[model samples]
Target: MTVLVVTNDFPPRQGGIENFVRSLCDELPEVVVYTSREPRDAAYDATLPFPVVRDRTSMLLPTARITKRAVQLLQEHGADRVLFGAAAPLGLMGPALRRAGARRIVGLTHGHETWWAGVPGTRQALRKIAEAADTLTTVSSWCEDQIRPALSPAAAQRVRRLTPGVNTRRFAPNCGGEQVRKGLGLEGVPVVACVSRLIRRKGQDTLIKAWPLVQESVPDAKLLLVGGGPDRQYLEELAVRTGVSQDVVFTGPVPWAEIPPYVDAAEVFAVPCRTRRFGLEPEALGIATLEASAAGKPVVVGDSGGAPDTVRHGETGYLVDPYNPVAVGVRIADLLSNPQHCKELGAAGRQWVTEEWSWTRSGAVLRELLDV
Candidate 1:
C-alpha cells in the first residue's frame, strides 16, 4: 500500500501536531510526506526515511494550489491513498482531493478542532471535510467526541480513534538522569517539573499560586519550569510576587533529545492544562505526561479534555482541577512525601505505557482502519 501524507506541520515546526505527523510517518509503510517549502527544512528533510515532496507555496497550508500538485504526486507515486495531518489543510481542499480519484481520503483531528467547531461557521466547514473523508482519525477519544457529532450518522462512523503515543526507546526509565540534578544545583531534595510551552492555558500561574503551600510541607523542594514561551516574564514576576521566586527555576526550552533527563530529574511531573482557567482549549492529550510515565515518574494533570487520559488518576498520577492550585500542591506534596508510593505509581505508569501505547501499535491500528 502506498500512502501520501500532506501537512504544513513537520519536524522543523514544533507542536503536538508536528510531532504526531513525524511519529506516524516513521511507523507507516510505503509513505511519502509532503510539506510546505521552508528554507530551514531543507537540511531536516534529508534525515527523514521517506521521500519528501516540498511544495513551493508561501502560506503555511497550500490550500489554493494543493489540488493540482496532490493529483500529480498521486499519479507519479502510484499511491491510492492520502492522509491529511490536520483539519485545516484537509478542509481547504478536501472536496477537490475527494474528486481526484484516490481510493481513500483520511482526515486526522486533534483537540483544537473542538475549539474551532465552537466558532460560528467552522462547524459546517468541519462537517464538509469529514463527510468527504473516507475515514477520520482522532488523537484521543475526547477529540473523537468533538468531531463525531458534526457529521451525519453515516459520516460519523468514519471517525476512528488513533490515540497519541510516546517513544519508549527515547523516553524510557533509567537512562542516566544524574546530569539534570547536577545542572540545577539541586542535591537530593524533592523536585516537581512542568515541561511545556509556558502558555496561560498550561496553568503555570496556578502552580505558582500553590507553591507557598507546597513549601510549607517540603521547604527544601524545587519547582522546575521547562520550555519557553511568551508568558515567561509574567510567570517569573508572578513567582516573585508570590514569594516563591527562589524556589522556582525556569529553564528556557531545552534540546529535544535532552528532555528525558528533565523528566527523570523530578519525582513528580506536572502539567496543569485546563479549559476555563485561561479560556482556551484544554490540552488534547498530554504527550509529556505519557513521556513522564515512560520515564517512571508519576504525573499530575488537570481535570480537563484529554489531560485525564494521560494520568489514570490514583493509579499513574492524580487529576486535579487546574483552577485549584491547592489540589495541585497537595498532590505534589503527597507524591514527594512518600517515596515508596511515588515509586510504585511511577512503576505502574511505566508498565501501562509499554503495554498499551506504542507508535508501532498505533500505526498498525491506523493502517487497519484505513485498510492500507
Candidate 2:
C-alpha cells in the first residue's frame, strides 16, 4: 500500500499545486516522496513524517536517466502505487515505473496540462501519458474538458475529478488577524487582498487598474498584494503609474504558514486571474480563492478557466471579467461598502467550504482511486 510521489512541484517550491500534492500525501498511510532538489528543501524534508528523496536536478524532465532513477526508487521503497504531482511530462515515466514494480499509477493535472491539451505538439505527449496512467486526476471540470479531448477515448474515460481541499481550521474566520492588521497599519482600513504570485495572468495589473475605482468608493481602502514572482517589479511600477502606489501594500513574499492571518485580515479577497497566451494559460482551479472562502472572506474572483468553480457567484462571492477593471472594482467596492452583506457572504462561504471542501473528503477520493 506504500505510495511513491514523483513530482517537481513539491515544497520548498511554493505553489498551489505543491500544496495540493503535499496535502493529499498527508492523507496516505505510507508514502515516499521523490522530487527535485530545491533550496532549503533539506530542512523542509526533515520536518516531514515520510522519507523524501531528492533528485540532483532542480527541474525533472522525462529523460532516460530520470526514469531509471524513478524505477529504482519504486523498487527500493516497495511502493506499489505512484502519484505524479503534475501529470504532464513526469507522468510520461508511468509506463516505465509500472514495468519496474508500480501496480497503480495516478497523475494529477493542474493548469498547464489544460493548455497542453490544445497545442498540437504537446497534445500527443499528453495523450500518451494519459493512456499510460491508471487514472489522471483533474482539479476542476473545465480542466477535465480541456484535457479529455487530447486523450484517447479509453484514457478520457479514466479521467477523475480530485479537486484541492482546504484546511478549514487553518483558514477560518477570526484566526488572529489583529496583529497582522496592526503590523501593516491596516487597522480599521477596508482592505482587498489578493494572495497569489505576481504574474500577468494573475491580473495584479488589472487589480491596479481597478484600484482607482475601488478607492473612489472606499477612500481609505487598501489593496494588499501578497506573494512574489517575476511580475513584482512590473506590478509595483504599474501601481505607481496608476497613482495608487500609496494605497497599495506589497508584502513581497509571505511564507505559507503565515498566509492565514493575512487572508483573515482582508475584508474582501480577490485574484482577478485571467486566461492568457491566447487561451493557452488559465487559472485552473484557484486554490487561493477557496482558501479565502474557507477563511470567511467573500471573494471577487476573475471569470477565467476553472476559477469560476471556486465561487458560488451571488452566494459566496461575485465573478467579474478579469479584463474589465470597472467590473472588478465595482464588485470589490460593493463588498467593502456593505459590511452586513459582506459578513453574510463570508459566513455562507465558510460554511460551504467546510462542508464540501475538507481535506478528509479529498483524501477519501484519493484513497479510492489508489484502491488502498
Candidate 3:
C-alpha cells in the first residue's frame, strides 16, 4: 500500500503534531511525505528512512495554487491513499483529490483546528473535507466531539479517535538527578519544569502566578519554562510582577531532540492549559505530559480539555482548575513536601505510559485504520 501524507508541519519544525506524523512515517511501509518545507541539506534526505517530496511553493499563495501542486504530486507518486495531517492543506486538497482518480482519502484533526464555533466559512470548509474523505481520524475524543457536529450522518460515522504516542525508550528515567541538577545550577533546589510553547492558551501566565506561592513553602524550588512563542515578553513581565522572576529560567525553544534530557532533569512537570479566544483549551492530548510521565516524573495538568484523561488525579498526577493559580500552587507544594507520595505517583505514571502510550502500539492502531 502506497500512502502519501500531506502536512505543513514536519521535523526541524517541532510540535506534537509534527512528532506524531514523523513517528508514523518511521513505522509504516511505502510511505512518502509531501511537505511545504524545502530540505535544508542533503542530510534531510539521507536521514529519512523513506522518500520525502518537497513542494517548493510559498505558503502565502492562493488556495488554488496549493491545490494544483498537491494534485500534481498525487499523480506523480501514483499514491494509493492520501492522508492529511492538518485541516488547511486537507481542505485545500479535498476538492482536487475528488477531481483526480484517487478513491481513498483520510483526514486528521487536532485541537483548535476543529473547534470552529463562530468562524465564517471555516465550519463549512471543514464539513466539506469531512464529507469528501473516506475516513477521519483525530488525536483525542475532545477533538472528535468538536468536529462531530460539523459532519454529515455518514461523515460522522467515519470518524475515529486515535491518541498520539510517545517514544518511551528515549524519554525513560535514566539520567542521574544529581548530575542534571548540578548542570542546570539546581543542585539543592526542587525543579518544577514546564515543556511547552510560552503562549496564553498554554497557561504559562497561570504557572508564573502560582510560582511565588510554591516558593513560600519550598523556598529552594525552581521553575524552568521550556519552548518559546509570541507571548514570551508578556510572561516574563508576569513573572517579574509576581515576584518570582529570580527563580524562573526561560530556555527559549530548545530543539526537539534536546527536550527529553530536560524532562529527565526535573522533579515535577506542570501544564496549566486554559481556553482562549479561538476556543476551549485547544489541547487534544497532552503528549508532553506522557513524555514527562515516561521519565518517571509526576505531572500537574489543568482540568480542561484532554489533560484530565492523560493525568489520573492522585494516581499519576494532580488535575487542578486552570483558572485557579492558588489550587495549582498548592498541588505543586503538596507533591514536593511528600516525597514518598511523589515517588509512588511517578512510578505509577511511568508504568501507565509504557503499557498504554508507546509508538509501537500507536502505529498498530494507525495501520489498522489505514488497513495496510
Candidate 4:
C-alpha cells in the first residue's frame, strides 16, 4: 500500500516523533513522506528511499494555504492511506486529504497531542480528526486513555494502541560498554546517563537535584547528559547550585548514530519525565529508556505517562517520582552500588525490549492495520 505520512518533524530534525516516523519508513515499502522542513541541498533529498515531498511556505500564508498545500500533496501522491503524525495541524489536513482521493485516513496520536481537554478549539479540532479518520492509533495505551474521553462514540471504538518499536539491530547489546565509557571520559567513575532534550518536562533538573543524594553515597559516580536544548544553561546552573558540577558532564546534542554507544556505556539510564497538559508526559513509550534497556542497561524512569508500561518496576528497572530528587538519587545509587543487581536488571530490560518492541514486529502490526 502507498502511505503518505504527514509530519511537522522528521530526520535531520530530532525528536521522539521524528525518530518514530523515520523508523516506520524503514519498515514499510512504497512509503512517501511529506514534511514541513526543507533540506539545504537538493542532493540530500535523494538519500532517502521514498520520495520526500517538502512544503516550504512563508509565515505570511494563512492556515488555509498550508492546509491546501497538504491536500495538494496528498492528491499528487495518490496515497491509498494518509497517516497524520499528530492530531493537531497535521490532522487538520485529514478532511482535506479524504476529499482528495485518499481512501483510508489514520491520525497517529502521541501523548499530549490528544490531551487538550480544556482548550476550546483544540478539543474541537481533535474531535474532528478522530471523527474523520477511519482509524486512530496512539503510540501507547496511556495515550489511548487520554484521547478516549474526547473521542466520539464511533471514534473511540476505532482508536487502537500501536506502541513505537525500537531498532534492535542498531541499538543492540554488543556496542562495547568499556569503549564507549572511555570515549566519553567515564572510565573509572560509575556512569548514570540521561539521553533526552535538556528540557523541564524531561526532568533533567529533577535528576540534577537527585544527584547530591547519589553523591553522598557514591561520590565517584558521574552523570552523563546527552542531547541539548534551550534548558542547557539552566540545567548547568542547577547542577552547580546542587553542588554536583564536577560529577555532571553535558555532552550537547550527540548525533543519532552515536547515541547507542552512549547508552551502552551507562551503568543505568534515567528518564525523569514530568507531565505537561498539552503534551503527554512519557508519551506512549519511552523510546530512550527502551533503547537503553536494549543496550543491556537498566533504566530509571518517572512513574508518570507511559513509562511504567515499559520500565517494569523492580524487574527491568525502577520507576521513581519525577518531582522527587531524593527518591531519584536513592534509586540511582542502589543500581550503581550493586554490580550484580545492575547486570540482572539490565539483562531483564534487554529481554523485554527485544521480545516486545522490535521494529519488525511493529511493521507487521502496522501492515495489519493498513490491510483492514
Better of 1 and 4 by lDDT: 1
For model 1, the superposed segments whose C-alpha errors exceed 4 Å read 57-59, 276-280
Model 4 weakest 10-residue run by lDDT: 54-63
Which of the predicted structures, 1 or 4, would earn the higher TM-score when compared with the native? 1
- Clashing pairs counted in every model: 0, 0, 0, 2
Q: lDDT by residue for model 3 over 1-372, one digit each (tens)?
A: 777788876775678888888888876787888776544624566788777777675242227766777777778887767778775436557767767756677777777556652255877777777777877787776777778888788988988877778878888896555665677788777898999988877788888899888988899899988899999999889889988889888889988887887888788999988766646456677899989998999999987666677888889998888889999999999988888888899999999999988888878877777677
Name the top lDDT candidate: 2
**lDDT (Cα atoms) of all candidates against the true structure:** 0.81, 0.93, 0.79, 0.79
Work out how many backbone clashes candidate 4 has: 2
Q: Say what the RMSD of model 1 is.
A: 1.9
| TM-score for each candidate, following the candidate numbering | 0.94, 0.99, 0.93, 0.94
Q: Tell me model 3's lDDT, rounded to 2 decimals.
A: 0.79
State model 4's lDDT: 0.79
lDDT of 4 by residue, 180-238 (tens): 78777889889999999888888889888998899888989999999999999999998
Best-to-worst order by TM-score is: 2, 1, 4, 3
- Best prediction by TM-score: 2
Q: On a 0 to 1 TM-score scale, where does candidate 2 land against the true structure?
A: 0.99
TM-score computed on alpha carbons, candidate 4: 0.94
Quote the lDDT for 184 in model 1: 85
